[model samples]
Structures are given as C-alpha cells and as structure tokens.
Target: MELPLDSPADQLLLAGDQVLLVGSSYGGRPLAASRGTAPGGDAVGRIAPGPEVPKLVLRTVDISDPAAPHITATLEVEGAAVDTRVVGGIARVVVRSQPASLDFVYPSGPSSEQRAAEINRQIVEDSTIDHWLPSYALEAGGQQSAGRTVACDQVHRPASFSGFSLLSVLTVDLAAGLSAGAGAGVLADGQRVYASPENLYVALDRYEDVPVPETAAPETIPATTVPTPTAAPPASTAIHKFSITGAEPAAYLASGTVDGLLLNDFSMSEHEGVLRVATTVGAGRWGNAVADDGAPVSESFVTTFAQDGEQLAQLGQVGGLGLGEQIFGVRFLGAVGYVVTFRQTDPLYTIDLADPANPAVRGELEILGYSAYLHPLGDGRLLGVGQDATAEGVRTGAQVSLFDVADPADPQRLSQLTLPDGWTSAEHDRHAFLWWAAAGLAVLPVEGATVSADGSAVAPFSGVVGIGVEGDQLAERGRFGHPAQDPTCPPGPEPRLVPSDDGGPEAAAVPAPPATALPTTVAPSPALGGDEAGAGTSSVGGGSSSGVAPAVVDSPWCQPFEPPISRSLVIGEVLYTLSDAGLQANDLQSLATLGWAPFA
Candidate 1:
C-alpha cells in the first residue's frame, strides 16, 4: 500500500514490520535567517537569493497489515537524502546539505552596476578557502547565529580546495527508535558511495579549470602568432574510507586520490578487507589534447588497497588497460576482477587481485561490443546485459552474452543473443535483472520495435523476457507482456544483425557463426508440478497456479514519459516486479503473472 507524504520519497527500506522512508521537504527560509553567510561561501553561483531550505525527513512506517500502512514516527534534519542502507537493526543514510545563506544577498539601494559589483564582491568573499573548509562559523553582522556547520576535524580534506559540497551520514536505530548524530565526516559534493559490512567508501571526482594567462607580446608581433595555452588534464577521483561500527561512524580512515574518474557505483568492490577500484583515466574533458611528455593517457586501471587498522594502504596498481577506451563495466568475484572498456572494440580485461601488493592483468579478450552490466552465474560463467555493436563500435540493440571465465588467461563468450531493435532495463540498472539459479532462468524487462514489410515501424511492445541457461547455451523461454497476450502463440520475426567490419587477429580468436533467427512460437512449460492446461495465459486478477502470462500493449518508439520498471526480485518459486503501476508476482517457472497489487 502507498503511504502518502507531503514530500517526495527518496528512499525506502523494509525490515520486518518496520518501514523507513526518507523524503526531501522544501520550505521557505526565515527572514532573519537569510542575512548570514552559509557554511561554504557562495561558490555555487548565479542562483535565486534566499532560496528555500531542503530538509530530509525520515518517516518510520508500521506495515503490519498488508492493506494499510501508517506512519509511526518522523525525524527531520537539514539536507537532501542521497542514499540509504539498512543492516541488522540500524539504518545509515547519506545526506547532502547547503548553507542557508548560500544564495546572494544584495544591498537594498544600489544601481545596477553597483549591485553587480556588490554581488561579485560577495561571491569572492564567500569563495574563500575558509568557507570551503569545514568548521567555519555561520555569522552575520559579527553575531553568532544558529546555522548548519560541518565539523572539519571529522572529515578528510584535500590538499587544495575548490567549491563546496557538504556530505553527512545519519545513523538511525530502528529497534531503539533513536537518531544518532549527523555522520562523522564531511565530503566533497557529488560522491558515489559503496559499502561493505564493516566499512564504507566514498568516491569524489574533482575537476578544476586551469586559467590560461595572457601573453604580452611586442607591438611588432602579430596577434595570430601567439600560441594558445594547453588544456588542463583530466579530472581525478578521491576515495575515502570510513568505519561503520562505532558509537558514531568513525572519521575517514584513509584517503587517496586516483588519477581518473569512476564510471559508476559498480566500478568499486571490496573483498576480504581489500578494495579494488577500476577507473578510466586521462580522457581529458572536452576532447583536450594530451601531452606527449610520457604522461598518462586514456586508459583504465585496477588499483588495490589493503585495510590496516584505520588506514587504507595502497598495495599495487595496474594501469594502461584498454588504451584510448573508456571503462563501461567492472565486477569483482573474490580475487578475480573483470573490466569492460570500449571505443572501437570491447576489451574484457581479467585482473587478478589475489596478491594485492602485485596486482596484474591475467587476460584480455576483444569483442565487437561492450557489456555495461555484468552478473556472476555461480560457476565460472558470467551473464552480461548490454548493447550489441558492430566492430566499429556502433551500438545496435540489447544483447545478452554468456561468458565462460574458467580459464582467466583465455575467457570465451560461449553464447550471445541480441535483439536488433530492442533495449533492456538491465543494461543501465542491474536491479532490473533477476536470476533464479535453481530454475536456470534469468529474466529482464525488454522493449522492442519492428519494421513491417511496408517499411513503416510498428508500435513497440514492452515485456519481460525469460532466458533459460543450460550448460553453455542460452534459450529464449518466451516473452511475457502485460495484459496477458497469447502464450501459445509465437513472437514476430527477429530483427536483422549488422555485419562487423573488423577482421583483425583479435577478432579471429572466436569467430561467431552466422546469426540464427529465433523461433516465432514457444511451447508451454509449466512449473515443476503445475498443470499444462492452466499455463496458456492469465492477467493480474485471473491466473491459475501454473502461471499467469503478461498482457501485450503497443507503445511508441520514443516513449520519454513511459513509467519505468524499477525493480525485480525472485523469492522461492515466485518472482516480484515493481514499477510505477504497482507490484506484480509471477510464477518463476511458467513466466505467468500470479497476482498484482496496485498502489493505494
């Protein structure tokens, strides 16, 4: 059931009968509170004056009854919630807050030019390092005021300062119903967080524009003869580690800067007290020229760090991976790490992190397209969901690849299935993909379009496709759309594949056979003990124990306003899918809908 609140819900966690919802609430600032300087000076320029304050509200909801859920308690604090994680009986949330005086305050009676000068002066005054650094006082007219200030001693600071972004972690005890103090540290803005059972890692990408100083040439010299200044290098990422098990979250254990940017949250992994980070470095912003002075260039690196008490000690680093390419995906399985980087070709690099002090690349396999999301299949196999592309790196459509990495030195793609005119949600959000190991089944939300014989594109169809994995091969169980389409019927003809142009040595390693068209129809395969007659098709309200099929509906090719399929999870013999529409449960074996609950 839906528990409506005044603010927009940012995150939610369900533990037993207790539900925690974090929402962002915006309200006008008090008149008296608008005159002071914010914790960090107004480096965030050109905005409204005295903007509304954003407060994060944590609402505890009791969900004992499935039909009704009510709010139990709430704790409000200043900031916008970024992410939340629940473990045991405690919940940790990451919030970002700004100073109340972050906006500009102009003098009441000044000319336009004078007002501009005053604003610039205020900006310069606010841009001081004192404002950017934590622990600064929030004051106006030399008077102490009640305002938000981040404790500097609690956070790790960079050697140089830039603009300001304050990050706070809030800890809540669900059992005790207590709110801990704002987290133990401050961080630069726009950070992605990754957590382990014992520690948390925060990564921040920092970029500073290098000002080009003008040259004063002799009057005889031509203006065109002046050489332009070289562009600055690519941005860097600073990673900080914090301990989670303390009265208050411990301060940053250790911090280090990597010479690159992380692709996303999947780029980091912590295993057995060691942290491995994969990043794409040296790709200068805006296609800037790279210096040829033996400096680093566009490449990916897998760096390893070992935890020592309160510090993360850099063990070893392996660089120069996928030269001239950007990292698309990274996954770590114990001591082995897989990295996918793409430009003209996809290079799947296998990195061995068993020896953290001397990490090395174990293998490199070049393919036509890259994988944006990678999932382990429990054996030596990996399931990759991403776009298929030609040898020139032109992405075509959604593709699923089964890779066998049993031999790290020679990983092989055992099977590949592609839909020429479709995209799957799993590519960008791994949570949309579900794996049922017992049934050897994998399901993902897919949407595709087709061009009829008249050369006109037919409306696209959205559904969930079930893939059955047996040994080294992949089989399409069937596609189940909403509104319960014909299950015994067949799908339309498969889309055509684009031929590759590359015929290099790497491309010759495992030559792909001619593409095969998928069968139009699939036979009904009931659950282990389900009846075959009850498996034809069923909708949300009507379905048999065997399975309930999804409904089929036509949609536009570019559906910008389409509600997304947010989450998919499998429990026991049932599969649950959550979307804006509501929650749906399907039989894991028959791929049929069992029940659905709409938002109340």
Candidate 2:
C-alpha cells in the first residue's frame, strides 16, 4: 500500500515500528498586504510577488506492518528544516526562518498628505549618522483614544538589512505527539551540523583582518635594512554547544571560538566531557590562496575544550601538525584522537586527549595517501577509507588502510588495499561504510574499472565490496550489484533494393532482415565464494602468509547506468542497501538478494 503526502520526504528515520518523515511544503505571496489593509497604491501596476514561504512538515508513520505503512500523525511548522536527528523518542530539528519581505507604508487620506511630504523631506535630508538609526519611531497620540503612528527616518534601505532571519531549534516528542520550540539563536546562515544523544554542536566560521599599525619612519633610514610587513591573524572557528537533555528541550549552553577553520562537521568530536576540534589554521578561508597574513600558510592543530559553567573554556592545544598541509580526517575515541593531514604525503597523527589540560601528539605516521574518513575498529585499530596516491602525491584511486594503533607511540599501517581508478562514497560520507565487528566484515560502495589480462581497464561496475578483516589481515569476500537488462535500439525503416546507376538488371532485393527476439533480462553475477580456508583468509599482517585471492565478477548492472547506491547498513544477518530506485536486502554471508522495497 502506498500512502502519498503533499510533499516528498527529504529525510526519514526509523524507531521501533514507527518512521518519521520530514519534508518541505511551499504557497502565498511573500510580501502580501496584512489583514484589513487598505489597497491605495496602483495594485495592477505592481509586479506580483514570488512564491509563498516554505514550511517544514513532519509526518509520523506506523510501520508495524512492514508491507503497508500508514501515516499516524503529522505536524507543520514555519520555515525550512535544515537538519534533524532522532534519539529515542526525541527529535531535534533545526529550522531557518527568513522574513517574507520588507514593505513600507504609503500615506493615504487628506490630512495625511502634508505628513507624507514632511516624511519624505526628513528621509532625504538625513545624514549618514541619522541613517544608521532606526528607520522609524512609534509614538502614541491622545489619552482618551490612544492612536499610534510611525515616523519614517530613512526612505529606503537594502531589503536584506531591513529584516533579520532566525535559526531555531525545536524538540518533538514522538510518543507524546507534542513539539515545542527549544531555543533560538542568531547566525548569518547555517552550515554543517553535528549532534549526539545529549549535545548539539554547530560550527560557524569567522574571519577578521588584523589591523595594520600606523607608524612614522625616521628621516634617514639605512639602505641595507628593510622592514617586514606584519601578518594578519588566521580565521577562527566558533562552535556553539547546546544541551539537548531534559523534558524542557535544548538550550544554548556555551560557545567557543578558536583560531582556525575546521574541515567540516567531521572534524569535531566530544568525549569524556571534552570537545576535541581538529582544524587547519593559517589556511585562508573559502580556499583563498593566501592567508590574511599575506603568505601561503597551512598548518593543522587540535584543540581541547571543556565546559566551564555556561561557557566552554580551552584547556590545551597541540599545534604544528602536518605543517603546510590541511586536515583530512579526524576521529575521537575515548581518551585518544586520530588526525589525518595531507598534501604531498598523508600524516596520521595520534593525539592523547586523556589529559585535556595538556593534550599532546603521541605519534605520527607518514603514508603515501590520505584518509578522508576514519573509523575505529575497536582494540586500538583504525580503519581508513580514502584515495591512493603516487610518490608525487598524485591521487590515483580509492584505497582502504588498516592501522594498528595498540601502541600509540608506534602506529603502523598493518595492511592497505589499493583499488586502481576506484572510488567509494565512504571517502566523503562516513555513513556509507559499514563494519560488522562480530562478523569481521566491512562493506563499502565501490565503483571502478577492472583491469583485464591485457592490462586494459574494462567492465566498470558499481556495487558494494565486502572485505573480511580477520585479526590483522584483509580479504576480499565478493561484490554484489543489481540485475542488468539488454539494451534496446529503436526500429529502423524497412530496407528497399535500388537499381544500379548503369541501368543494368536491378540488384536483387535486399533480403528482409531476420526477425529479432526481444531483449532478455540478465541476472546479476553471483558473489564470489569464500575461500575454503575460511572467510577473509587474506593475511595483511604477520598472522597468515597465504592470503586469500580477490574474486572478479562481471555484470552490466555495475555500470553507472544503474541507480547509485546511497546508503548501506546491517541488521542481524541482513544487509540493506538503499538507492534512489529502492531498498535492497541481501544475505550478509553470501551477498545474495533477499528482498526489495521499491519507492512509490
């Protein structure tokens, strides 16, 4: 059963037997007249306003019956939803609201004629100082029957400055079917957002130019001496923390702005009451070539901050990490943090955060390429998904690295897999990569060209690659993709025989083309069988010398012509892969199709 709504769902989350869907709806003129307003101006002459303001809608669905989900309830709120996260029965959503439009009142009636002229005169005569003041002032007239009028200060101003927008956080209780505004804050706009079960962090970038000092030089300066120009300070990152606990909803707890800019939301992590931020300072903002200091600068640093009352106070900082390089990945686990910075080479740095007041870099390992996303594999091992690079730092394709960090002071890359001309969504979005510790399996959406025996790249395929991690070794289990279908070409006109130019006997009529059969559906290639020794039998470290060989599967379904895989997750022994086309469930062990749910 398909249940259609007014708007397409943009995001969804499942909790128990319920699914929450959030979408946007749009309708009315943005600058329409208020209720009971008299239309005096030339209504016909004015241009029509644009589409109505956008509103966010939340729909709750009961999915007890997996085959036929039904909408249980819905709630609407003004503004567009930016980001949302659901923890248990609580849903935290961030919405951005902008003023409809800026409109000024025009005078009407006989007595108001003279007042209108005076208002125009004041607006034209106001100086710069007065222009900075409020545009209008409200005053009360008479005692018995009070009347209010607004005195205009400026006749015109930019629409953007005339009104202000708001960034609001709202909390919704799915079980109680109630929602309330948690808190409101000011931001020029919103960017990437990060949230945990108990805290929400918003990263905002800030730029400020250091003022150059004015000085007078001496009358006779030495010809051999040259004065150097002062450098400007680097950009800063302001992280605002909000507490999302309690029945009252979330509220801003504190904000800490440090010198540098974070790569993105993934560069921040909070653990053990301390927030660790990995940022690249000295690097100009928005990809500017040079910093405000007027020099090419690049330096990575990690700072630790702790909550102090209602504000976050900086405890300590470690700098000079991967100097001249930018940060690529950051992961915080317990009292340890891993940072990947790269330019010509990838430098994976391990920072000890156990002492927040004095955080220090414990170890550093230099590798050929960099990891854009880092995941902890428990027991002091880290999994990295990024790109492979040459000695000259030329990125070739996607690569996965397994690191042994049991000894923080001596981190080593246990094993690395290089997929030539290949890429994975996990490099940019960590959620795309799934790891099952118990099963010793990691699945990643891999797309790339396969090299043939003749050293030619062929048979490009898009699908999930299952890598089995046993102890310190890595083995390729198999690959799975959607089914394929033969191509279809439009029918052409029937062939007709033509006489020769010499006017000789006409050439025999071109034989009618043989009737062709309809194109047949092609089943997807089967997954490679596991090695007889065991699953993930490839040895990447000292454990097993006989490594399991990778399996090759050829299927047209792996081409880009098919829907791209967007997300993947594992539940029990079933692996679920979602794409624009639909959801596909596969057996975790063999990568065989189990079920499918097509989008309606």
Candidate 3:
C-alpha cells in the first residue's frame, strides 16, 4: 500500500504512544508518548506559492497533550536529519533545505520539475536555518501546524510582522488543535540569508559578483546650421511627372521624442527641394507667473534637408517669451513662410517669414481663444480658423479670423466669426482620456481657389463670417459654415452677404498609373548652372531677413524653397513637394505669384 499519497491531503494523527507526521513526504512519524499516550498539544502549518508559479508548504500540530511529551518536529535533508539538539531546555530541530530560486519571467503555467530542482540546489548551497527558530502553533481551523521558532508554547505572533519575514515563531498556546496556514520563521543571527516567497532562503551577496548584460539606446542625429549658397542663373524648367494620388509617403524623416510637450499643431512646407516643417509645441510647463504676464513662451525648431537625405538642418530654433513659445501656427502665406503663436493675454501671433530660415515677428493679434489652423489668403493675408467662446460661454466650431498682412511687420485681425447657436463648445474642448498630442483637424488648402488656372469657385471659401482689412477695422461679416446637400435640412443658412464665386479654386486631378508594374525610372534633368542654381528665395526677389521666406507671399502650387542637385527634378510654374519617397508636383501656373514646375 503506497498510503495513497496522491489522494486529497488529510490531517496527520498521533495515536497513543505514537507520533505520526502525516503528509511528511515520507511515512508518518511514530514516537511513543512519555505516558504511553499521544501529546495533548496543538500544531499549525502554512504554505504560500509564487505569483506566477505554484508551490507547496506543510505544517503539523500536537495538542492532545497525551502526557505532554516534548513535541519534536523534524525535516529530512536527503533522508537524513542532522544536528537534532536541545537549547535552553527546548528541542531545536533545524533542517537545511536547498535555496529557493525562481524564474522571474515564466510562461503562464505550473512550475517545472527542473525549475524546482534548481531552486532546491540554490537553497541547500546558500542558506542557513536555526533549529531554535522552528516552532508549532494552533490555527483557526483547529488543525496541527509547525513553524520556525517556539514561543514558550503560548502567545500570538504580532500581525505587523506577519507575512513580512520568512522567519517566524509560533508561541504555541494550550489550544485544542493546531491550525492550518500558521507559518513561522526563526531569525538566527545571520546577515546573508535571502528570504523567498516559498519560505526558502538564499544568499544574495554570493550572486552579487554575477555580470549582467547592458541595454543600448537608439542612435539620434543633432541639429546643425544650414550652408550658404553662391549666386547663379535661374535653372531651366523641366516637365516633372508625378502620380495623381495625393497620398503622402509613410517613411519617417527626422524624428525625436520630446517629453512633456504636447504638439498643438504641425505643418509641412518645401524650400529648395528640402522639406521644412513647423510645429507648435507647449504643455503644462507653463503656469501663471507674474513674469509670464499672460504671455505664451517656448522653443521650436525647423527641420529641413541639408544634403541628399544624409544630413538635416535646424533653423528658427530660438527660446524666449513671445518668440519661440508664442508661435501658434506655421504656414506658407503664398511663398512667404509665417509662424502663428500666442501671448499669455492675447491669443494670436502672426510671424512674418519673409526669411524662411530666420522668422521675424510681424504682428501679434490678441484673439479671444486660440487658433487651430491658418490658411494663407495670399499676399500678406491669412484666414485663421478655430473656435471662440459664445456669449453663452460655449465654444462654437470653426470661428474664422480673417486678417490683412498689407504690412508684414504689422498683421491685424480683420474679423472674427463664431459657430451658430445650438452647437456646443464642449465638442472642441480637450478630453482628458485622449492624449493631448494626437491628431486634430488638418487644414488642407481649398483646391483650385485663386491658385487654379480655370479658377473654379465651387469650393468652401465662399463664406466669410469675419474679415480684417489692411487698415480697416475688424468687422463681423456674418456666421457661415459648410452647406448641407441633404434635402432633409431646409437649405442651410447663407451667412455671407457678399459671397465670392464659390467655383474659383480648382485642383488638377492626376490619373492613376496602370497597375501590375514597378515604379518607373525617371530621367534626370539637364545639368544646372552648378550648385549655385540651388539659390532659393523667400519672396520672388530675394530671401528675407530671417533667411527663410515671407509667410504672406503666395505660391499657386507647392514650390521648393531652393533648387537641389538631383536627378529628380520638378520644374515649370507648378508647385512640387519632395521627400525621401520622391516628389509630388501640383500645377499652379495661374496663381498670382509663387508658381513653378518640376525638373527645372
């Protein structure tokens, strides 16, 4: 009879003149009681497992007081009990089991035999348990349990130290029986014993000499200054072909993570075949300080190509109040570049980028709230679109702010428009759950408007809730929004008193290339007047003081800031956008100024 070890566990029993330790991983112990009867004492036991792995524990009890024979607990080590001795008139039974080691990152499952063996080996080679530390006590379940130290066979263990240390002593009381889950440890004077969840001990100091691997960080390139170009004749115009699809390539250019800075908005522009992007950066860092005076301050950098995708240049990266931080939006007012930031008190900043590389502060208009997108109306003017607080204190959607930049140095707000009643401002407010720097409304140019050759006027630019003339006072034209085509909604309100031709702007749609083929090999353009041909202009005449471009200038289509030395050419008076994935050319020969072809 194998004693049915695999069956559900049962409490151990000590018959008269017999000490039977059941579930002892061995045959129950049979020690004759002093008076030829079982001890009338109680015992306790407890076992806790690992978080990701399962383990086991066992404890015994003696409460019958069968003649009150001194109870002795023994744990076999390799089937051999060593150093069974008595200290201070009490039997100190200490068994040295192997160290308990566990795999920190284990799969979701039970522990393997190999893992348990390893843990046992570590414990045996590295741990030391004191015999006097072993004790037995009774538990609530009225079962026998054994623990680390003896507590004069009386008193309860303090709850504060419970479950904290592997060493515990149960002060056995004259209870009826031992209790289950009663664990204890004996703290013998030693410093190297590493406590483990399975009640096994190991020496951490021994493993301190083990070498661990180090982690490596990803590489990053820093920003540098742009090089000066030499004077040369304007390059020849070439017909650069582009796929009609307006999809942008997914390849990442220069990228870095800026913690604590929520990106308010971002836009991309092209100069000299290099992609220059402006992003409004800010966040909780700004608290109301008297010195702040209700002004927005921060730092921003312009990322652009230096050479053939190998190097990058950073410009307009200044740090100060109302300079770098105040910039709200960055857009190309025509060919001229401009940055829109805000002040603490006022809510608008119109920066003139007559110089693309170096931007100069033009006008700072104090709007009620903040601007979401800035659309260039060409020639020192821009259409700022966002929401404003209504009299009811609600934010209406798409409040249009028209401005006149007749003087790039002093941009004034022409007018402000608000959303109609019934619409809520909460829709525009930020949600705490969503990341502040995620996606928002993208301000795309209205196709064909004033920049198209046919100049179709059937676009969304027909309404003007507000308009700010160069020298005129800002006036509220009327409220307006996209008219619904659904017949259910009685023709939407037409708020513009003097609506411009809606069919003015037109975009040339390109035909998609035939499928089942790889990208076609494009022919390089003819030699230019050398690198000097790379000269770029912020305006038609020259670059501005900022070394970039004027934000108010207009370009019929996307044009490169300057010419680049590449077999890839974009020419004619068409606008061309280039990146690592290649180029996209928009034909804008009809726009007032700022139009160019690819491969020129």
List model 2 lDDT by residue over 424-514, tens digit each. Answer: 8898877789998878888888776363213455466466677888778776666655433223433434777778777898764665544
Residue 260 of model 3 has an lDDT of 20
Candidate 2 segments whose C-alpha is farther than 4 A from its true place: 28-52, 102-164, 178-188, 207-234, 285-296, 308-310, 451-457, 485-519, 524-560, 594-600
Cα displacement (Å) at residue 269, model 3: 1.9
Against the unseen true structure, what C-alpha lDDT does each candidate score?
0.65, 0.64, 0.30
Worst 10 residues of 1 by lDDT: 539-548
The number of clashing residue pairs in each candidate reads 8, 3, 109
CA RMSD for every model? Answer: 13.9, 13.0, 34.5
Stretches of candidate 1 off by over 4 Å are: 30-50, 102-163, 178-182, 213-232, 246-250, 284-297, 306-313, 449-459, 484-564
Question: What lDDT tens digits, residue by residue, belong to model 3 across residues 41-130?
Answer: 111111222322211222333434644543333221211121122222222222222112311221111223244444445644554434
- Whole-model lDDT, model 3: 0.30
Candidate 3 residue runs with Cα over 4 Å from true position: 1-266, 280-309, 321-328, 342-344, 352-357, 389-398, 419-600
The C-alpha TM-scores of every prediction are 0.73, 0.70, 0.28
Residues 451-565 of candidate 1 have per-residue lDDT tens digits of: 2213345445355667889889987765544332222333434454444467443322333433333222233433333444324323221112112222332322211222345
- Error in Å for residue 158 of model 3: 59
lDDT of 3 at 441: 15
TM-score of 2: 0.70
lDDT leader: 1
Of candidate 2, the 10-residue stretch with the lowest lDDT total is: 142-151
